[model samples]
Target: MAHHTLRLRVRRITPEAEGILSYELVASDGGRLPPFEAGSHLDVHVPGGFLRQYSLCNDPEDTRHRYVIAVQRDDHGRGGSRAMHELVREGDVLTTSYPRCDFPLLYARSYVLVAGGIGITPLLSMAYVLRRQRVPWHLHYCTRSPERTAFRSRLVSSFAGRVTFHHDQGDPSQGLDVKALLATRTGGTRLYCCGPAGLMRSVREAAILHQWPREKVHFEAFSAEATGAITDRADTEFQVVVRSTGATFPVPPGRTVLNVLRANGMRVPSDCEAGSCGTCLTRVLEGEPDHRDSFLPEPQRTTCRNMLVCVSRARSRKLVLDL
Candidate 1:
């Protein structure tokens, strides 16, 4: 799929919480922007040539006028957040891909939203839509402290009775009881979770133990590290053959299929090279994949029809890809 880019001007930059900043983007020409849905994210081409994905937090209904995104500065990260915080300024022009959604909200009787830290970005948009539609839903936002919670005042004022704040104060044990909260499955209720890997994993396990339908649970990870793709496992050299071009490349240890393909002069549409985004998903014509991506559902991993080349590898000696 081809992604279109839009040049936008930074209209405002607000400090939402400690280490977090919310940026409001508008069309550079002072016109309406493209429409987007809840859970959609923008692929920001940050200064210094780094591409980072940020979820849209503002109401989707207002997307025609502007788009809002929150960025959490990670001093230890690969510098995307740092660039946005230290280099980006209000009124500067920025380039971003059209909004894309991987964690879209589905129709259900009610909803349970789980957010951890900056993961509240996408869920906040969902809250707006649910509220407008008069659906029954609740947001459980978990943060280290009240000072670190983004959109705190807005959430309290707008979602008053439907939002619960969980502050663990850096202690995991004092956090929300994910297991207990999901102990019972309600008919026609769906769960949407976006957060650190621990929280999402816990929600997945709890939903499974309580017999929640797999289709009823959804998740989106904030970073590649949260997906466990960057691991300590030793990698081995392998070969990949492109079915369309009949081109073969050797994927050596410590390098990803994406890197190899791009180095070989192949253009692949990708957003999050960490495998959290499904932008680089490629069909697998042959071979089993060492699936490391959190983007693929559990059932899809078993079928092995597709793979995220960014972080996944071949369990077989060779892979035939429908590139």
Candidate 2:
């Protein structure tokens, strides 16, 4: 789906935790903002020419004139979060895409929510919606310490017994036992997790060892990780054929399809170039695609009908795209 870009004025900025800042954005015209679901996120165009995605933590039931998002300042990141923390200010106008729910919550008998650090943002919204519907759900929030936890007071007041806190105090051995949690699965409990790479890896491994239904377990990765394709010495050169204009472009080993298309004057919308976001998805009419993106499910990837051009490549020498 396409996103609508709108200029929003920063209404307020407050510290959510040690390194996290919460920003409240409202329309410049003081109009009602677009409605978003519980797990929806916004692609924010920071002061720099880069875009970053942040989850909406506000209650979906309130169709107010504002949307709230939390950003954890990462100095070593792609500079989006740092720019937002350092340069953005209250009343400053910022452009953001309409809400996109990449990590949507489907119908489940119950949910076991697991979050690490700022990963709590999306799950917090899910908790609000589930509470409203009176659905059985529990949140297991893991952080380094209580001081590093965002929305601690709000969660404590709202969720009470349903929320459990796991603090490591900088010790991994003292952290929450993810393996134990996955091993003792309750009936009809759908799993949802978002966190650092290590935590996500542990969750995935546990789910695999315990034989959890793959379809019932969901997760989202924001940052790109090192894959074999990145450092592969056998990276092949390929050609892309645009079905619309019938123009062919050569894609080199180090270049991506999206970059090649953009260089050729094809303007395509993209938010996160890391392949986690499905914003730059394009249809593949021909050829087998070496799908590298984690956004598409296994069944969809096998079909090679749609691909994320940002990171995915073609296994065949020549491929046709529905551009």
Candidate 3:
């Protein structure tokens, strides 16, 4: 299905941290925006026509008039963050996709929230909901240093005694010991983590080593590449056959199925081509998919019934897609 788009006016832009900026966006028509959950994110259409996903950090209950998002400028990475920082300004109009959530807050007796660096955006919203619900929860926010920690003051002021800040000063060894923190599994306690690939991996590995219930652990990555979804293995040439049209296309190595379909004049909608977004998910009629996407849950990946064409490829010589 095609995702809904919104034309929003940039209401305000405030500095959140050393290199982080928060944007307050409101509907251009002065209407109430659609409500979203705590971990929802918006696919922002930034300058240069690049669609980047930014987590909504504002309280979900306060979305009656506006949506809030934070952008961390990454000079070493892609140009999306750079464009958002350099070209976007207050009062500017921008296009964005409706809010979507893959990292939703699940029901549990108690919750442990771990966030690393800019990964705090969605977890911050989760904190708001958990507080409102009066649920037992704690946030362990880790950053390189206090100066680079976004929303530190807000977190401390609003969630005193419930939030802990960890500064590693550019060393992983000094950061939170994920293994020790999750050494014991508490009954009815769920763990949610969003952060750098290393942190999330550590959390996942620790949870597995400690024999925590897989269903009780959740993760949301900033990019598939960081999670090893896009580069874990080399790609091989394959064929994609459209079930409806009976037309086939060759998918060469290093090329994505979405791009191949689009180049062939097929209109496949996509947002984050990194496979972190589910915008380009397509049903598979036949053949197994080498699922490289971080968006699909375990069930979906195991079933191999649907695949995100953005980053996933076919395991068989040819894949018959519902298209």
| Among all candidates shown, the one with the greatest lDDT | 1
Q: Give the worst 10-residue stretch by lDDT in candidate 1.
A: 225-234
lDDT of 3 at 205: 76
Candidate order by decreasing lDDT: 1, 3, 2
Q: What is the per-residue lDDT of model 3 for residues 1-323, given as tens digits with 9 covering 90 to 100?
A: 11468999999999999999999999999999999999998877788655567889999988989999998887665467778899999999998888877678989999999999989999999999999889789999999999999999999999999999999999999999999999986799999888876687688778889998877888776743333343223345799998889999999654578878997999998654546557788999899898877678777787759998977777789999998
Superposition TM-score, candidate 1 onto the true structure? 0.76
The C-alpha RMSD in Å for every predicted model, in order, reads 7.8, 8.6, 8.4
**Best candidate according to TM-score:** 1
Report the lDDT tens digits of candidate 2 across residue range 132-209. 878788999999999999999999999998899999998867988988988877678888888774576677778889
| Clash tally for model 1 | 0
Q: Per-residue lDDT tens digits of candidate 1, residues 1-323? A: 11468999999999999999999999999999989999998878788766667899999999889999999988766567788999999999998888988778999999999999999999999999999989889999999999999999999999989999999999978999999999976799999998886677678778878988877888876744235444333456789999988999999644579878998999988754546657799999988888878778788888859999987888789999998
On the 0 to 100 scale, the lDDT of residue 223 in model 3 is 45
Q: What local lDDT score does residue 10 receive in model 3, on the 0 to 100 scale?
A: 97
Clashing residue pairs for model 1? none
What's each prediction's TM-score?
Answer: 0.76, 0.73, 0.75
Clashing pairs in 3: none
TM-score of 3: 0.75
